[model samples]
Target: MGTINTTTNERFFVDYRITLNDGQDIKKIAQEICIEQTVEIPEDCVPQTHWDYGITGIVEDIIPSDKIKNQVLVSISYHCDISSYSVPQLLNTLFGNISLKNNIRIDNLRVPQSFSQLLPGPRWGIDGIREKLDVFNRPLTCTALKPVGLSSTELASMASQFATGGADIIKDDHGITNQPFAKFEDRVQRVQAAINEANAKSGTKTIYCPMLNDEPDLMKKQVDFCLKSGIEGALAAPMLIGCGAFVSLRRQTDLILMAHPAFAGTFFHSNLHGATPAFLLGRFFRLIGADISIFPNAGGRFSFTQEECNELSDALRMPDNNILPAFPAPAGGMRIERVSEMYEKYGKDTVFIIGGNLQQLSDDLSVATGLFLEAVRNCACATKEIL
Candidate 1:
C-alpha cells in the first residue's frame, strides 16, 4: 500500500527502510512511525489545525526494498516547524521514540537546504583546510601522536618528525587526553612547539591539531589553550561529547575541527537496524561542525563496506546546502601500500591517515612519514601531474 503526499511548502522528509520480519503490517507500521515521530498523542486526540496545517508526519510511501531481501522502505515527512530550528529536536522528530522499536533504519534524511545553517556545519571546509596546508591537487597526509603511554616529549618528537617529513597535518589520537602519562596541556604545548620548529626549518605550513574531548566548557577551555599555543586545529568526538555540545563548539570557535568516530559503532552495527554511515558520518557530521570527518576504511581492521565509504564521500561533497564540503579521512589500521587504490576511490579531496603503517615501516618516523607523503604524491590514479 502507498500514501500520497501533496506538495506542502513546510515539510522535510525522512526515508526509513524497515524489515517486516515478524509479519508487521505496512499501514500500521507507517502510521505508528508518523505518530511516534511527531504529535505523539492518539490519532483522535490530535487537533484539527495540525492536520490542516501539515504539522503531523505524513507517510509518503511504503515500497519493498530492492537490495535487502524482504525489507521495505517507508518515507515519512514532518512539518518544518516541528524541528523547532534545533538539532536535538530534529533528531527527536526523526527517530527519538522509534529508535527504541525494532525493524527500522534511517536510509535517508533531508531538510530544506535553506535551513541548514541552523545546525552550524564545518567552519573550515575542504578548500579552507587545503588553503591552511598550502597543498592542493593531491590527497592530504595526516598522522596521530598515538599509543598513549608515550610521554608528552616523546609524542612531541613524533610530531616534529611528521612535520619535518612533509606531513600536511598532525592530530592527537582519540585515546589521548588528560591521562597521567601525557596530560592535555603539556602535550598540546610541546607538540605545537615541535611542529612550529619543523615548520621553521622546512618552511612548510604543516598544522598541529590537538584533541579536545571533555565537558563543553572544558572543551572550550582546551580550545583557548590551543589558541595560546598557536595550534591551528583540533580533533573532537561528537558522539562522546553529544551533538548539541559539538554544535555549540562550532559556534564558539573558528578552529579547523576533525571529528573522530569513537562510540559511533553502536548506531550502525546491525543490518536490521540503525543509521547509515552516509547520514551519520557524512551529512550529519558535516552539519555539526566537522571540517574533516574520519572513518574506518573498507579494507582496514573495521568492517565498513566500500559502498558505505562511497556513499559517505558523496554526502560530504554533494551539492551546496548552506554547508561546505568536508574531507573524509579514511583511517583505522590503514597501510601505506594502498595509497594508489585509496586515491582512486576517494580522489584528490581526501585525507589519508596512515598511523600503524608508518610505525611498521621503519624506526625513523621522519623517513617513514616522508615515504607516506611520497606515495600519495606519486599516486598514478590522481588527476594532476606532479608539481
Candidate 2:
C-alpha cells in the first residue's frame, strides 16, 4: 500500500515510478498512490494542491501500461521530514518509495531554501569564529599555503610563515593531493607541525584545516589523520565528491568542516531549476555541518551578484534555522581594498579568503599575510562600532 496521512506546513513533490514485483489491480495501485503521497507530504501544504491538476492532486485518470511510467512525474508538498536525514537524503527518501510503475521521479522542488530554513546552520558563523579566535577587530584573516606542486617541506615552511604572520587559518590549497611528491599524509603532517611550531613560538592560535577530498573510504581515513594530527578542521568540496559525502563525513567525524564550492556551477545558472546559491552553499551546507562555506564572491573570478551574495549571507544566519551558523568564506575576486567593503556589507559573519591576489600583492607572504589580517581587522573593528 502507498503511504497515507500528510503532516502540516510540509510541502514536497513526490514523483515515483511504481514497479510491481508481480502485478496488482491498477485501481488499487492508484488508491495506494494517494495513500503514499499522504505519507510523504505533511498536512498543511496538502489539500491546497489536492484538487489542482498537473502539480497538485492525484492521478485521477490513468491508463496502465506494460512498462513503468518512465515519462510520468508527480508533484507533491508534504510535511517535509526535517527531523532526521540531511537535505539530500530527505530528498531521496521522499521519492524512495511509491510504485515506479506509476510515478517516475520527483522533479521541481521549489524553495528547498524554505525547507532548509527549517534546518540548523553552521555552529560558528563569521563573527562567531573570529570571536572564538579572539580576533575582534578585522574580517577574520585567512590564507592557503599552496602551489599543490610544492614539496611537503616547502608547503610546511610557507604555512609556518603564514601562521607567524597572523594567518588565523592556513589551509591546504584545494588542489593539493596525495601525489608521491607531496603525499596527503606527509604534507598534512609537515604543514601542521609547522603551524603548531609557529603557534608555540608566537602564542597565536592558528588552525590548520587540511583538504580531505579523496575517495569515500580514503576520505574518512584522511579526516581521522587530520584530527589525530591535531588539525582543527578540514576542506571538503561537496560538488566534487557529492552532497551526501559531506553530511556522512561530518556525522562520523569531529572536524570544524569547511565546505569548498567546486563543481557547483550548474545549479545556480538557471533561476527556475536546481537550487539557488544561498540554498546550496548557505542553507544546505550548514545543515550538513560546514563551519565555513566558501563561495565565489562578487567582482571576483566568478560572477555572482552583490544581491546574490547578500542573500547567501542572510541564508547562512537566519535566526529561525536550527543548523549551526557557518562562516561565509567569500573568495574569488576579493582583494585588500574590498576587505572593508565586504566586512561592512556582510557584517562580522564572514571569512574573507583572498588567494592569488595575496600572492600578487607581495613577494613576501608573511608581509602580505599581515597586511591582509590588518585590513580585515580594521574593518571588523569599524563594523562592530557601527553595528
The per-candidate count of clashes, in order, stands at 0, 48
Candidate 2, residues 288-383, lDDT tens digits: the string is: 678888889888889898878987877776664345566788887678888888877787657788777778888777788888987876765665
TM-score of 1: 0.94
lDDT (10s digit) by residue, model 1, range 60-115? 98899997887898899888778877878888888899999986888787777656
Q: Candidates' TM-scores?
A: 0.94, 0.74
Query: Which candidate number has the best lDDT?
Result: 1
The CA lDDT of each predicted structure is 0.86, 0.67
